[model samples]
Target: MEENNSFSIKNWNEDDRPREKLLLKGRTALSDTELIAILIGSGSRNESAVSLSQRILASVSNNLSELGRLSIPELMEFKGIGEAKAICIAAAMELGRRRRTGEALERKKITSSNSVFEYVQPIIGELPHEEFWILYLNNSNKIIKSAQLSKGGITGTVVDVRLAFKDALQLGAVGIILAHNHPSGTLKPSQADIQLTKKLKTAGDSLDIKVLDHLIITEKAYFSFADENML
Candidate 1:
């Protein structure tokens, strides 16, 4: 069934309204467009909220992960999404990401690169820029803290080697896992990436801290330096 674009949801049958649909049929029964319409709240002068949401989802091929990556300004480019509406959408997306990351307790032990991905992916996977993070682990290989060392552009970040070990030394952490996201979606490490890993590992060595692995994270995959014997 095709909806009339010009008609507001107010004019539609109550059953067709996204809010009503969620109430009657439950959340799983609502489409992605309906879920997004609930976030943006309203549409432009000539369009219904549902129609505007459909256009927004269509812009990203209806991939929620892709939609999660859009910057606030990018969302504001939509016809009816002003700063407030765009902020609402971005906030909702972040909540969804955090909900996934909240399961980090289940992965407190750093067993493998895949285990690292499960805990860290939700925090950095969908970002539009670079973020360098360090996961500090006790001698038992359990996480002590995960902190962002630096935030920078798509090309790279300037991570201070001394700062990398500061938290580890304070927390009595003997193991460190380096991680950063690539918004460009490339898994291959640049010379800068490899060099930084080497430099940080050397710095950690002097402190008796083990640089266990360096992971280059993308939205759906990761490259592990330890796994590849590059460490």
Candidate 2:
């Protein structure tokens, strides 16, 4: 989608815009689109950097994984994405993927929602699309195994409850923690999120496995169903 607005990012309020927001509120405060806009720096004559970045992301169904698969030529096909902009995007996406891969090679214990965020943020926090993951923990709350259950859950309904718990049974995990990232940078749990957490909790109960928590992760913050007494 080509943005018809000719206004620049500068036209927005200093505090409200991506560049200034990052400076004032820190990097974690900006959304995925805003981070991409910062990398590309400027948009074409008819689009703001933010708009061009949004259009680029929209082309990939807002999946950063899809965006990472694009070649420079493929990214350049967009109206405002050029060779330089494409290169910048390509580099950043590569770094993000590498960082996630490196982190996933190790295991971490889940002591709290904040701990879950620290371990999982590099994997999903900055993506343009939603992802659901399950952390299967041994009796001591140490992570023994992890799996990606679903690729899309912006509405919080795409995860399969059976699939999420199947590995817990195989791994002989005593407990499980549910986690998924919100690309929109909102920490509020949707009704679907609540329902999904309840559904999974109910299923885990019959198997004698505990559902410890469900964390809704964002760029900087997270919402914990267990912490809020929602689960």
Q: Which candidate has the highest TM-score of all?
A: 1
Residue lDDT tens for model 2, 1-231: 555563455467432488877877899998889999899887777777888888888988998877886889998898887798889999998898787756754547777888888887777877778999899999989998878898974554388888777788889999999999988889888888888888999999999999999998886688888899887
* Candidate models: Cα lDDT each: 0.89, 0.83
Which residue pairs in candidate 1 collide? Answer: none
Q: In candidate 1, what are the lDDT values of residues 160-180, reduced to their tens digit? A: 888878888999999999999
Could you tally the backbone clashes for each prediction? Answer: 0, 0
- Report the alpha-carbon TM-score of model 2 versus the true structure: 0.61
Error of 1 at 160 (Å): 1.5
